[model samples]
Target: MDMRLEVVLLPVADVDRAKQFYAQRMGFRLDVDKPVKDDYRVVHLTPPGSGCSIAFGVGVTTAEPGSVQGLQLVVTDIERARDQLIEGGVDVSEIFHDATGLFHHAGEVDRVPGLAAGRASYGSFASFADPDGNGWLLQEITERLPGR
Candidate 1:
């Protein structure tokens, strides 16, 4: 038996706006956009090279918009990823790393300005948010940890 995370449900006040942000600004692949009923619709999107996708639309979730946070996307090059997002017209934060040389802290604790010492893998990060304020973090991982 295997459990894989294939999709994440996002809550947005305006479905079309969220769709445009994720599909056009974020450059995610639009996989599905179907109206299930008069008040229900489904929109699924996947990142460029990711198996997991995100879904949002009418009647998809009851959570408040901008409530989802700490969503992470891994990249091999943090600077390139941040540049790409900025080029796409997204407001991305400057690259930073944890002062403790481990994972980042919640909110903005232990956040140091610029990349980690020696540009270590899994240590560099940049952050951004969608139109609805759903936070996204870009982590640079030149090499994965054991069994990742």
Candidate 2:
């Protein structure tokens, strides 16, 4: 059976503010914003080239705002992506790479300054957080690994 991930529900204190951040600052396309019931609302947004979208609104989720962490957005060029986000008023972290040749170490332990030598795929990363402190990581992956 084939299973495709679709939407992710993000918890936020205010719907309009979160909508503005995603739609304007993050440049995610606004897909839906509607009141579902007396106290229920649904808002959906999709990133520029993403198949999976994010949703946030009243009565959508019980998770606490800013509780979500370590969400990742993969890009072909880490520098360019980080620059765009910064230009869009996001406070992004300086480019860094992990010392380990494999996946990055959690938190900030193995982080090294600057991009990996020769812009290595999956080697470089930058991070930022939304107004409510929803953490996001920008991972550079130019090529997919075999069988991926």
Candidate 3:
């Protein structure tokens, strides 16, 4: 059996505001924006070149707005991706790598200045957030590991 991640649900205070942030600012493609009833609405979006998508809206989730964190988006070039995000009006962090030369520590614990030495795959990263503070990390993966 092959299981795949298809959609992630995000909680938001205002659906339209979240929609604008993802669709206009983040540049995600809007797949759906439908009201199932007077009290229920769902907005679905997918990032460019991504198979999984994100959804948010009224009555969709009980989680608090801005509660989600550490969501990652993989890219072939961290610098280009970060630049595109900045040009699109997103506030992104400066590119950095973990001091331990492995995965990054949570919440800026071991963040070192500048890109990883030799620009190793999966080593460089930048961070940003949505209007509701759903944190996102852009990880530069130039090559995939075996079995990925």
Candidate 4:
């Protein structure tokens, strides 16, 4: 079972705006951004230090904005990240706790749904939304679980 989840698609109201936000504001590197056709522009971006990238476009397909959903990002520290986003004027949810201490509550993350299970093996964290109402959850792992 070596199936790799290399890419994920995200929807945005404006391609250029979203591109800048991810590339400049959020610190993701631009993978690809070019005109594909008359009404479509293919854009791909990778997070600062990750293997996977997110692809998005305008008029490329009929996929509606805020529909792609559910991105789980684990950070070394959740409180720091939350503060940064909050200082940047992004609306963040109150931290909540999952059954596991490693997971925190982010009250009603607008679009994307919750996690599956056992993500909080280390510590807990929370999330907020991007400009276009897309969801982004920052999970903070406190420690390592038992065993390998």
Off by over 4 Å in 4: 59-61, 87-89, 99-123, 142-148
User: What TM-score would every model get versus the actual structure?
Assistant: 0.97, 0.94, 0.98, 0.73
Q: Give lDDT per model, in order.
A: 0.93, 0.88, 0.94, 0.68
* lDDT measured at residue 74 in model 1 versus the true structure, 0 to 100: 96
> What does candidate 2 score in Cα RMSD to the true structure?
1.3
Backbone clash pairs for candidate 4 read 96-105, 102-123, 102-124, 122-142, 122-143, 123-142
Tens-digit lDDT string for candidate 1 (16-107): 99999898998999999999897999999999999999999998899999999999999998899899899999999999999899989887
Q: Worst 10-residue stretch by lDDT in candidate 4?
A: 109-118
Model 2 alpha-carbon miss at residue 97, Å:
1.1
Q: Tell me the TM-score of model 2.
A: 0.94
The Cα error of candidate 1 at residue 124, in Å, is 0.7
Candidates 2 and 4 compared by lDDT, better number: 2
Q: In candidate 3, what are the lDDT values of residues 20-47, reduced to their tens digit?
A: 9999988999999999998999999999
Model 4 — TM-score against the truth? 0.73
**TM-score order of candidates, top first:** 3, 1, 2, 4
The lDDT-based order of candidates, best leading, equals 3, 1, 2, 4
Give the CA lDDT, 0 to 100, for residue 10 in model 3.
92
lDDT of 4 at 90: 64
- RMSD values for the candidates in order, in angstroms, are 0.8, 1.3, 0.7, 5.2
Q: Tell me, by lDDT, which candidate is best.
A: 3
